[model samples]
Target: PSLSLSHSLSLFLFLSLSRSVLSPPASLIVSPDRSQFFEYESVSLSCEVQGNSARWRLKRSTVFGERSDCGRNWGKPQGSSCIVSLIPSHSGVYCCESGSGEHSNAVNITVHGDRVEEEGG
Candidate 1:
């Protein structure tokens, strides 16, 4: 018995799909990478995927227990990246999520309320 051309092609496609399914999800890259940030600052969040990043979107769960996507009411989406103006309310966990339900590593961000001034005694 011999395999048909269509059968071989189907097998190849299956293997390719299997490899992608087993591969790790995309990663969320943060600019000026740090856990802490001051209020009124800006941060950049982008998705680094195996292929095109346009399939992924930046998401966040704020400290106020609100979940939302970028470019909605939070950050502005520019290409595959999101530019966010930092605020105390923006302190939360951020990550990248694909349309296929794949999620990247989440990052915790903290935005300080205000800078305290020190007085000389």
Candidate 2:
């Protein structure tokens, strides 16, 4: 009986480790496949996983030190994709994260356009 219990415990640990090894982090897919954009342009980002894509959400960290999630403060979430309107101030790093705390690879996006400012005294 002692040996049977010990073997069962070992099998449980091995199965746990195997599950972790079998699941790879999701990947972020950017439509239009470019990192640079002009003002007024829109970008679509999606999360690619082996199973369900709905488990992930888009996230962004702007150059101004602001972080936002899709459908929360910035992009519009459409199904498994997030659509973002581009502006010069929207340049930042974007990625996908799952509710289980799994993070995908990140991409850096830069918006290039004129920033108009009035001369101040």
Instruction: For each candidate, give its TM-score against the true structure.
Output: 0.75, 0.72
Off by over 4 Å in 2: 1-23, 114-121
- Give per-residue CA lDDT, model 1, range 75-97, as digits (tens): 99887789999988899999988
**CA displacement after TM-score superposition, residue 23 of candidate 2 (Å):** 7.6
Model 1, runs deviating above 4 Å: 1-23, 117-121
Best by lDDT: 1
Task: Give one digit per residue, the lDDT tens place, for model 2 in 5-39.
Answer: 99999999999889767765688999999998878
- Least accurate 10 contiguous residues by lDDT in model 2: 112-121
Supply every candidate's count of residue pairs whose N, Cα or C atoms clash at under 3 angstroms.
0, 0
